[model samples]
Target: MSFDIGNPSYGLVFWTLIAFLLLLVLLRKFAWKPIIQALNERETSIENALASAEKAKEEMARLSNENEQLLKQARVERDTILKEAKELKDQIVTDAKVQAQTEGAKLIEQAKKEIDDQKKRAMAEVKNQVSSLAIDIARTVLQKEFEDNKKQEALVADLLKDVKLN
Candidate 1:
């Protein structure tokens, strides 16, 4: 028998159909089941990785917010400390000024008292010198008057006449 190019025999067609069906059954059992199972496992792993990435992103956002709040709190604390330091500095300056003024006033008063004391001492000394000079002048005049015998007799007679019995 001669083989035809376009038309096949009935026996050959029947055998080809049986062989195709057998190949499909063998591929399903050996390759198709494992391939489908592997694809399902790959899909599940991809989903788990996406979930983990989302969780990490949320955690980073929360951390950023916490850090900002902490920075703001630190700034507030720093400002408070600076304000207290400024107030303390001003108070110290004011106290120093007051103390200096008080000391200056005390020194002025002390100086005035010292001057008054010196002036009083000087006046006392002048009065003593004047009294001593007056006594010396009176003694010199008496000595001159007593040197003349006739004046001395006349002075004695005047002094005796002025002495009267009370």
Candidate 2:
């Protein structure tokens, strides 16, 4: 721990310099170039990986937008289909109502025609019955009143002339 103001020994300084030079030479020859090259390659690989990641991110974003557009289109198509279906249902309902109305009208017309035919037939039947009854009554009266031929002929001619005048 004594202080000295003198130059150190040549051998010690020379050995120390030789050791430092050897260490520098060994590091330069064996470690520096490969370490720098490996560092550069690692940097390049990292840069390439980052670029690829950025490209993938862009592609994913584009795909996501496309998916959203497709979803919107699907929704629109479904809405259109639903609207068309409703319209078709409405048309079917309207057609059914029209058909029902036409059928009802046809049925009513047929019933009316049948009733008219029945009415005409009933009137004809009544007329036939009345004519037959009247003829029978007339025949019975004629039989009761007409025993003499000459008297019957004279009375029959007078009745016929009276009926013609009325």
Candidate 3:
């Protein structure tokens, strides 16, 4: 090993400097724009994903609130329907009671009318029987008084004519 510090290789040094400069020029021209564009696009995409996540969270919260409100409204509607049904039931019971009372009154009136009709018919029958008894007694007394048949016949005709004229 000899340390010849004084000798310098100028050609080799010049060639090395040229190769380094060419490599720098090639990377700057062909690769720098595309790589930098890729990095920027990645950053933009991450920002878009974060924004979408926040929007989804807000929308879900709003939808949950709406669901709760709808449930409350349904409960109110159900209560209203139940109240109306109870009122209807009460009204129906009252109507039934009134109808029963009216029917009872009608039946009582009909019974009274039947009793009055029966009483009138009974009175008429009694009067007819009394008249029949009187006629029978008169006929028996006339038969006893007249022994002769021809004389009795003449007396009956004359009495009947007199009664008709009066």
Please report, in order, the local distance difference test score of every candidate based on alpha carbons. 0.94, 0.94, 0.87
Cα shift from native, residue 133, model 2 (Å):
1.5
How do all models score by TM-score? 0.69, 0.82, 0.56
Judged by whole-model lDDT over C-alpha atoms, candidate 3 comes out at: 0.87
Candidate 1 CA-lDDT value: 0.94
Which segments of candidate 2 are over 4 A away from where they belong? 1-10, 148-154, 157-166
Give the Å error, residue 63, model 3.
Answer: 1.8
Worst lDDT window (10 residues) for model 3? 1-10
Please write out the lDDT profile of model 2 over residues 1-166, one tens digit for every residue: 4444496777777998999999999999999999999999999999999999999999999999999999999999999999999999999999999999999999999999999999999999999999999999999988877876988999988888888543
Estimate, for each residue in 60-105, the C-alpha lDDT of model 1 and write its tens digit.
9999999999999999999999999999999999999999999999
Off by over 4 Å in 3: 1-33, 127-166
Pick the winner on TM-score between candidates 2 and 3.
2
Clashing pairs in 1: none
Which clashing pairs does model 3 show? none
As for TM-score, the candidate ahead, 1 or 2, is 2
User: In order, what is each prediction's RMSD in angstroms?
Assistant: 4.5, 3.5, 8.3
Give residue 73's lDDT in candidate 3 (0 to 100).
93
